[model samples]
Target: MCSHYEGPTADRIHHAFGIRPDGPVQTDLWPGHRGYYLTSGGDSGGLSVSTGTFGLLPHWAKDVKLARRTYNCRSETAAEKPSFRAAWRQARHCIIPAEAIYEPDWRSGKSTPTRITRRDGGLILIAGLWESWSDAEGLQVNSYTMLTINADQHDLMRHYHRPEDEKRMVVMLASGAIQDWLTVPAGESAAFLRQYPAERLQAEATG
Candidate 1:
């Protein structure tokens, strides 16, 4: 599963998605950090950009730190996981735009950082769920997590991670289907959990 990525800048988002963020955007993101996500059915009733903590903070969480361990939710078990069930059941869908994603390459018998991106040089739009948590004083905090699917057989994805572990990759949406993924009916959103074609992606070891 993906826990690190090269996030897009506000200007890149405006150019690729046609939506401008309300404030400065974070470009480097990891668990427990702040980043931007897009949703369709917010207070605006249209596509809107929002800033949220990278790790999902469930309603039952006593503190915002819960995000650290809740950043990557497996799609196969999200419906039953305590940290993700509510968001998954409520269809709190979102799209996380990134310039690239980082994964570990272990083919050399040692873990080396690798960067994965589209061969076309377009944005990598990842599928995710969003949550809104309120504290005792009514302070609201938004958080999100990337969803992952099994990638054991994927030509490109299977190359990363450890050979002894199950291979998995983050769920991604085709650039043309961004709106459809965010607006799909509940219980049916799972249709978009399919893998992105490996032929369109490229990877390289990074220092």
Candidate 2:
């Protein structure tokens, strides 16, 4: 599962969002850090961007630390997992705009951070789930997690992670299909969980 990434700049995001989020956009993101997520505004027929913690914060969560382990939700079990079930049932899907994602490559008997980006040099619009939580003062807080599918047989993504671990990659949404993914009924989510076509991505060792 991915834990680090480079996010799009505020200007780049503004072009897509029509406005920038309130503060500075984070360039490097990790679990528990702040980042931006896009959600479908109920009646606007458009996306609304919001800055929130990178990890998903379920209503029952006592603190934001849960984000560390909840950064990447496994697609196979997301609907049944406690940490992600509510968002799944609510169909709180979102797209995380990333410049690139960093993952560990363990090919040489050692771990080296590898950078993965789209071959076309466009933003990698990662599929995710977002949830809102209420703090002690009743203030609303938002958080999110990326959705991942098994990538063991993928030509590019399969090379990531340790050999002993199951390889997985985040689901990437195409621009044309973004609206469909955001508004589709929960039962149809499986249709959007497909692995991006092989070789549509490129990777290089960043460390």
Candidate 3:
């Protein structure tokens, strides 16, 4: 599974694509940070990462902090888990615009990182889901999670090796698949989602 990502050009491309660019975050030792946000039905908000927390605000949520830890959702059971089922069924779908994503190689013990990007150098429309939660202060928090699918045998898999890794990779939507993925009725089988070809991605090992 991917635990780190890069969104260097998120802001520049979001507007060009008619989407919103949330905000960026800076980690003490990380190379760089960027942000991405989304809006729907006249509601708008963006995502921000601070202290390693990624904050997302959805139209339905009253607070945005809830997204701090919900950045990833497992595809194997996302449709069955309480935290994700409802969003997966009803309020489903989000766009995570990223230039590239980072993956670690544990075998080297030196944290060898891999940068995965689209072969075409375009923004990757990562599949995600949004949800709203309420805090004690009555503030609503909006959060999101990136969905994962089983990774195909490839050079990238050499680095990710958790017994529970499940060999998963995030679901990178095809240009035309976004609208359909967002509007498809709930309870529908996700078979079509698994149909995307895996050859569209390219990954390289980096420092």
Candidate 2 lDDT over 109-187, as tens digits, reads 8999999988998888999999999977888989999999999999888888899999999999887887888888789
Residues 80-142 of candidate 3 have per-residue lDDT tens digits of: 876677777685566665678777656665566777778887767777776655666876545
Candidate 1 residue-wise lDDT, 1-207, digit = tens: 888998988898888878888888567788888899999855656578899999999999998888889999999999999999999998899999899999999999999999999999998999999999997799999999999999999999998889899999999889778888888876898899998999999998896
- Total clashes in model 1, counting residue pairs 3 or more apart in sequence or in different chains: 0
Selected candidate, larger lDDT, 2 vs 3: 2
List runs of model 3 lying over 4 Å from the truth.
8-10, 20-69, 106-110, 152-159, 163-165, 195-198
Clashing pairs in 1: none
Among the numbered candidates, top lDDT falls to 1
**Cα-lDDT of candidate 1:** 0.90
TM-scores for all predictions: 0.95, 0.96, 0.71
Candidate 1 error regions (>4 Å): 41-46
Error of 3 at 77 (Å): 0.9
**What C-alpha lDDT values do all the predictions have?**
0.90, 0.89, 0.57
